[model samples]
Target: MKSSFFSILQRIGHAFMLPIALLPVAGLLLGIGASFTNATTIDSYGLQPLLGDGTILHALLTVMKSAGSVVFSNLPILFAVGVAMGMANKEKQVAAIAGAVGFFAMHATISAMLELNGLLAPDALPEGSLGMSVGINSLQMGVFGGVLVGLGVAALHNRFYRIELPTTFSFFGGTRFVPIITALSYMFIGILMFYIWPSLQEGIMHLGALVNRTGYAGTFIYGFIERALIPFGLHHVFYIPFWQTALGGSEIIDGISVSGAQNIFFAELASPNTQQFSVEATRFMAGKFPFYLFGIPGAALAIYHCARPEQRKLVLGLLLSATLTAVLTGITEPIEFSFLFAAPVLYVLHCVLAGLSFMLCHLFDVGVGQTFSGSLIDFILFGVLQGNPKTHWINAILIGIPLFPVYYFSFRFLILRFNFKTPGREDEGQETKLYTRQDVNAAKAQAQKGDQVSNLIVAGLGGSSNISHVDCCATRLRITVINENLVDDEMLKSSGARGVIRRGTGIQVIYGPHVTLIKSNLDDCLHNAV
Candidate 1:
């Protein structure tokens, strides 16, 4: 079967997620480091005596924060490895080597090309330049460079992982050829980028300036587009540029500059404060805190309240869990999808209100950040722990409080008034069963320690014999089975699945953010199958 454009994009999005999982700890460490290092924070709070300079506490805290700092500092490499790992079907570690090689070569070659052309400099390079240690040497392609190298390496891995070569050069065939080709291929890419990037950086800088100049309006537009595009899984397209490129990235933090919004925030947090935290630098992010931490969950309450009293129990478990997930981790698909199909108008309204939240937060000058999503986890790690008297992070709550009512009254009234068929309101003809405690225990036992979840999921889908192929993109595990009758939907749900969809002999097992792990586990299950 031919894949569609949507499928290709979904796969790329999944690839993007491979490295995103590293942000939370980085956020936490950076927050703590920033809070302590700020002479004002300690002096104002009167912790000056204990956390003063030359104390072990201060030194230890600095070390802890540096642990997280290095991850973002080397993010270009992370992206290359992540994209390679995500795209490769097998021999992932080998592909990663190719990615690393390609990335280094691309950046180094670009640097050399620039030096030759006199278009670049070691001292006065552009702000988006990748490496300089504040001066500039090489490897300045940033996230865009990382992506190019990753894609290049992955394409080679997938196409030539099993290619044959003449007997004399057989040693260079298969996995061995990957890194060699990656290095050679990126030279051309580097040459192209050498000429293109200066102009590209200018364009990106202008775009970033445009958004920055718009201030609150730009934030609202970003929030609106982000939420609006969620249903199509294109929200990544809306945010990635802002998050990764010079557009919304490239802020100085703690003395060391960084790229990407979240990384910049963490980096900024750990750096010594010369001035009050800059809201302008963090404008792309601060608004999401309110929407994710409070506003969206308030919408969940509105949904539950509007659910039919009789069927409410059936959905309460799912809704509550979904709400908690949104509050804690900032994953909202379960809750969003609950009403997205039934009341799409409400989704539009949600996006608009979310936009309003962003605009309001910006106007108040409240700023905070998170690595992955907007959640209370972010609230605590990036907001509360990284507290500054000057930062209006607490204002997130004030804006968030109104949203609950806004979402509740609006959704409740609309659902009742227009008869939106959200959740419990669905016709009795649609049969639904929430995963039960008994089902949970069964799946848990079946999914053993090493490959427990993987094996149980395999069993649910009728095991190795029944499954002919397996692949995943983002939230769902896409599988091909020989017989549909052997697949058990309840079993899959019991195996910690969010949901299941079947089309012919193809099945999709929804697993939310951990789908990558599940896909790996499933692969392991097949490798160890009985």
Candidate 2:
């Protein structure tokens, strides 16, 4: 029972990646365009002649900003399609289409109910109580509504995609029945949400208020749990609500009330009337920048310095690459998993420091926002470019610079004192590299030939017969197997996984940020094998 629940949680978390993946480009376009078009920014930089109101540069930037804003604006529907497609066990494309169908049907039903209740008028409902969802005047359920539709539709899709029916209804028995059932089911759900969501919304608002009232401690706990869940691959599930819904707090941006931390930050970014960005909305995000940009690299440096002298040269390149990945893109598992399995004490310390970073940033009122990761790209686009007056981004710098040595010294002490077998200190003859590379060339060669890496992974997973599900998150290939005992951890490691995490039926093979490619190859491999 525990395994099944863990498997479901992993699946839902993986499902979130489909929509969350779209944020980077959208954020880039929005950040650059908003930065250039802002009157304050233009005048501050004295580039009026080149990028003034009527200039081509200004006009183009305006278009760019709008393009980015549209994605954020439509995230609910995107989540609907993404989650359904990600969660469906079969007929994924059909499930995706059904997700959209259900989303529209649900909102349309709620809109009808609101109009019937005379609650659709401009003043009929309290401000921010009734808002739009894909142009439907509906209750403000936010991304939660999209998620509800997606999960419900995917459940329906999985149950009925292969279902048989009476001869008279046989035409709609299989995949066709998915969308038909989804639309009808969500109509009832919409009616249910229409009646109950108001109270739920009130409760959510109170929860957000309570979270806000917790202030520094709240931010620390948020950051702490986010880092703590990394090993479990459930951090996305933990943070998505704060990033996308009322749980992160809400504010009126450009006369439109925007909920969620990222939403408020972006809306404020696009608004010309904005002065300083909202620190409250950004507390959930600013904390990541410091740790990702500085602390992780510091820890990497400590690992390198602690390596055996004879093995230092051999491990330097690997450590540098891992640190660079974390610093530039905010993907830390490569560096993290290196010591996570070897020296869990350091990981615990890292999580504690990460929490402190969040608390400090919140205390300083740093307002830096991020799209996906706290990479230098996001830092420059959303923080540096937005100006310190708005983001107080320099505060993150001030907080982070000192954290560097703290991480280095703390990690160094822990490694030496505990004699933690971190990278180079491994027993002689064992590879000193973090996350093994012994099979990289072989894995690449196999991938180029026919993705035999997938075959090895399949064998490692005890063949397709024992496997129940296969999915992935940002940096790990998540799977579920019937018999965990049959799984070979060493085989998966040799197939290029940095590490393997096993909990009953659930397995997560860490493969860094490019796990998506691995997942794609495995999908093809599985198809051919079947």
TM-score of each: 0.84, 0.97
Residue-wise lDDT of candidate 1 within 1-530, one digit each (tens)? 32334444555666787777776777677667767867877887888778988888889878877887877777778889889877787898999889988887877787787678675654566554646422336645567777777888898998888888999999999899888888898888888887787788778778888888887888889889888877655577578777777777576665445666655666567666545456765667777877786777777777777778887887788677777877887878767767766788989998999889878877887767668778787777667765655557788888888777888788888898899888777787854332334444544455565667786788899878998767775456867677879999988977677567665576777766556667876787798774
Residue 437 miss distance in model 2 (angstroms)? 9.3
Question: Which candidate tops lDDT?
Answer: 2
Per-residue alpha-carbon lDDT of model 2 for 225-288, expressed as tens digits? 9999999998999999998999999888778878999988999998999899999999999999
Q: What is the lDDT of residue 60 in candidate 2?
A: 96
| Model 2 spans with C-alpha error above 4 angstroms | 435-441, 448-452
Question: For candidate 1, which ten residues in a row score worst on lDDT?
Answer: 431-440
> What is each predicted model's overall lDDT from 0 to 1?
0.74, 0.90
What is candidate 1's TM-score against the reference? 0.84
Q: Could you tally the backbone clashes for each prediction?
A: 6, 0
